[model samples]
Target: METTNEFERYQKAKKQVEDIKGFYGHLASYVLVMGLLIFINLRYTPQYLWFVWSMLGWGIGLFFHAMKVFNWFPFFNKEWEEKKIKQYMEEEKKTNKFE
Candidate 1:
């Protein structure tokens, strides 16, 4: 039993680490690509700054990605789902008892 719990914890930790790593990788790619875009836009068309649009769009996506990885919205996660399911089950049990 102890070993099983330890294994589960290990898996959870591993998954969390992977999530963090994935976020960092995404950030790195964004930085590199945006840097290139900045150079291209400034060098070729100094009057038209179009990189801002791409940055805004991709930044929004990245922000959402970070939120999911960091669990900023806890209500949408696995633990919350499990808790809600159990709560409903308990309510059903109480109703059945009365019946």
Candidate 2:
């Protein structure tokens, strides 16, 4: 049981590290792509300045991704939601009722 618990902890840590790494990778890509887009927009069509659209669109997605990856979202999260569900299920079982 102890070993199993340790393995679970290790797995969770590994998953979290992967998520952080993935977010950094996304950030890097966003930087590179947006830089290119800005350069193009400035060079070819400075009057139109269309890169802002892409910037805002992808930025909103990046913000949400950061929120989820870093747990900045205060409302809830998958792990907390699952734990709550399990807790409520156990409580329902104890009461011999569910709603």
Candidate 3:
């Protein structure tokens, strides 16, 4: 019984991690597509050195997307999601206790 409970916890944690990653990926995709459009516009216009800004924006947004997808960036490691979910659960427990 104890082992089953532990397994369930692990599964739940893993699922939460995937869910967070999926959510981040979806949002990042939207940002990336917009950045791509900005890049294209800058390339075409080349009026006021906007290309640099577009590239920077695209790079930063893509970098985060890569980090979330790969779970290898220094600040956003795989463990981050686990910690976040655990923290959320802890907060929920406290909130529930008060209510």
Q: Total backbone clashes of model 3?
A: 0
TM-score of each: 0.87, 0.84, 0.39
How many angstroms is residue 59 displaced in model 3 relative to the true structure, after the best TM-score fit? Answer: 19
lDDT of each: 0.95, 0.94, 0.74
Give residue 56's error in model 2 in angstroms. Answer: 0.5
Q: Model 2, 1-99: lDDT tens per residue? A: 999999999998899899999999999999999999999999999999999999999999999999989999765897789989999999889888643
Runs of candidate 2 with Cα error greater than 4 angstroms are 86-99
Question: Model 1, range 2-93, lDDT digits (tens) per residue?
Answer: 99999999999999999999999999999999999999999999899999999999999999999989999858888999999999999999
CA lDDT for candidate 2: 0.94
Better of 1 and 3 by TM-score: 1
Model 3 accuracy (lDDT, Cα)? 0.74
Residue 77 displacement (Å), model 2: 1.1
Q: CA RMSD for every model?
A: 1.8, 2.6, 7.8
Candidate 2 least-lDDT 10 residues: 90-99
Model 3 lDDT at residue 21: 79
